[model samples]
Target: MSDYILGSHQPLAASYPLALVDLDGVAYKGHLPIEYAAESLVSARNSGLALVFVTNNASREPEDVAGQLTGLDIPTSPHEVMTAAQACARLLRSHVQPGAKVLVVGGAGLLTAVQAEGYTVVSSTDDEPDAVAQGFHPSLGWEHLAEGAYAVSRGAIHVASNLDLSLPTARGYAPGNGALVGAVQAATGVKPFSAGKPSPAMYDMALEKAGVSSALVVGDRLDTDLAGARAGGYHGLHVLTGVNSARDDILALPQERPHFIARDLRGLLETQPEVTRENEWFICNDARVRILDGALNIDSAGEPDELDIVRASCNAVWSFVDEGGEFDNTSIPHFSTL
Candidate 1:
C-alpha cells in the first residue's frame, strides 16, 4: 500500500458555506479558547457563514459544549453544535423504542444525552439493558468494560460515540472513547456501531440543524474532522495548534487530508484563495511546504521556534481579519522575525 495518499482537489467554489470547528484541540482543549480561536469564530459568524462546533468529545452534551464556548466569549447556541453524543443518541432513538434500557459506559454527559433522547439509562449494577452506549471518560473501570461486553453479548445494540483511539491534552496524548470500545470488543468479540466524527450521520445532523450548504470542517486531528469532511463532501481545514503537528502526520493520512492548513482556528477564518500568500507563512516551517500561489508554505510549523511564531501570527491575523482587512500580503515579512 502507498504510504502517501494525495487527497482529491476540491476547488473553493465547491466548498460549503458552513464551518465545523472541533473544540478539543482546534478551538480549545477544554472550556478556554486556544489563543485566537474565539476571535476566529466571531469572524466566521460575521462573514454570514453558519458555524457549528463539531466535536468527538463525548464527555459533554451539546448544551454544555455551547455554554462552555459562550462562557469563553465565543458566541454559540446549543443548536449550533453537533457532538458524538448527539449522534449516538439519534442512532439509538432510530433503532430502539423510546425508554429502551441502555447500559451506558462513559461520562455523565453521555448518560444524560442518551436519557434526553428518551432512552432509559441503566447501570452495570442493574439488570442487563437492551442496548449499550459507549462514551469515553477518565474514570472508566474494568468493571464497566465487563458490563458493556455482557450487554452486547446478550444481543444489545452497541452504539459508540466515537472511535478516536487517542485524545490531545495539555499533559500529552491520552486514550479516548475508542479505547473503551476496544476493551468491550475484546471481551465480547463484537464491534460497535460508531456515531461520531468521520461518520456521515454526525455531519448530516449538523447540516440539518444549521440548514446550510457545504461546510468547512476545522479540526486538530486529521483522522476525524478531515475524514468526516471528506465523507460529507465538505472542505476541511487542519489546524496545527491541536493534535497532529507535522507535515508527515498529514502526508500519511488515510482518508481525510485538509484542503487548507492553518495555525489554528484564527488562521482558518483568515483563509481565502486571495489571501493564500499571506497564509503561506503559517506553515512555512512545515516539512511539506507545498507551493501554493508560488509561495513556500509548510503543512505546520512544528519546530520549537516556528510553533511560537505560528501561535503569535495566528493571534495577529485574527485581529486583522476581525478588523476587515482584505487579505493584505504585508504580514509575511514580519512573521519571519519570530
Candidate 2:
C-alpha cells in the first residue's frame, strides 16, 4: 500500500464501478439531508456507479433507513442499504448453533438481524443465551447493560454491532453503542468483538452486496471509514460534510489518511487533482507546501479551491512525517483557508 494519497485523472463516478457510502455524516445529519448529498448521489447513480449506503447504525431496520433517504429526496431501496447489525449477526452465526439463543441488548434493528440469522433472540442472562449481541437503542438503560454484563460474565461470547463512541443527534453528539459496551466491559471484564467500521466485516459484506470489483469507500470520519477502507484494501474518499474538518483531516495519522478529500459528494463529479513533488515542494492544483527546517511552509498561494489547499498540505505534511520528520506548527495554515 502506498503511503501517499491516491489520485484519479477521471471523475470518481466514472473511475469506480461502485461507492460504499457512509450514512450519518456523508448522506445526512440527524433527520435532514446534507447539502448537495442527494443531488450528488443521484448524479453518481446516473453516471452508472452503483451506490450502497453503509452505516454503523444498528438501531433501525434497513427499510427504515432507506425510508429516511427517500424522504430526503434521495431515491433508495432497502436492498441498497447495509448495516452493522447484519455484520454482527453474520459473525454470531459462526460461533453458535443454527438456533442458539442470543440475548439482545439493543433495539428492533439488531433484534431483527439476529433473528434473521436463525438465532432465537432473548432479552436477559436468565435465558442462558449462547451469545450476547448489543447495539444502540434510545430505550436502552442500565438494566439492559446489566443483562449484557451478566450474560457475558457467564462465558457468553459478546458481540457489538458497532463501537462508535458518539452518535449525532438533532441537538448534538450523544453516547453511542460504544459507551454502553464500555459499561458492560467494566462490569463483565470482556470486550465485545466489534463488527462495524474500522473492522473489515461490514465492508466485506457491503462489497458482496454491491457486487462490484472496484469501489470507493466514502465517509466523513477517518478512523472508521478511511481506516476501514485501508484495512480492507480499498480506496477511500473523505468528505468534510460531518464530524472531522479539513484541519483535522490534514493532521490524521498515516493509517487514517484517505486517498482523496472533498468538500462534499459533489467531489464525485470532479477529477481528483494530482499532488506531485517539485523540487522541495508538493503541489496540488496551484497550492504548494514544503517542510523547511522542521517547519511546514507554504511556498505559494496558488489556488482558490479550498480542497486543493488541504490536499497539498496533507501531501507535504504526510510525506515529511512518514519519513520521521517533526512538524512545526508555525507553518500551519489558517483554519478558514482549509
lDDT of every model, 2 decimals: 0.69, 0.87
Candidate 1 lDDT over 1-338, as tens digits, reads: 11121122433223457777788887777444588878877876776667888888888777887888888889788888777887888889766898889999888788888988998888863576889999988888889888888889888989999999998777777888898799889888888899998887777887887777667777877778888877887767777777776432323233665556666666544523221224434322222233334333335535534533343333334434444544334324333422
Model 1: which ten-residue window has the lowest total lDDT? 1-10
Error of 2 at 285 (Å): 1.4
Model 1 stretches with alpha carbons more than 4 Å out: 1-16, 271-338
lDDT of 2 by residue, 236-331 (tens): 999998888888777888778899998899989889988888888877777777789977777655444667777878888888888898888567
Q: Estimate each model's TM-score.
A: 0.74, 0.97
Highest TM-score against the true fold, candidate: 2
| lDDT for position 64 in model 2 | 98
RMSD of each: 9.9, 1.4
Q: Tell me the lDDT of candidate 1.
A: 0.69
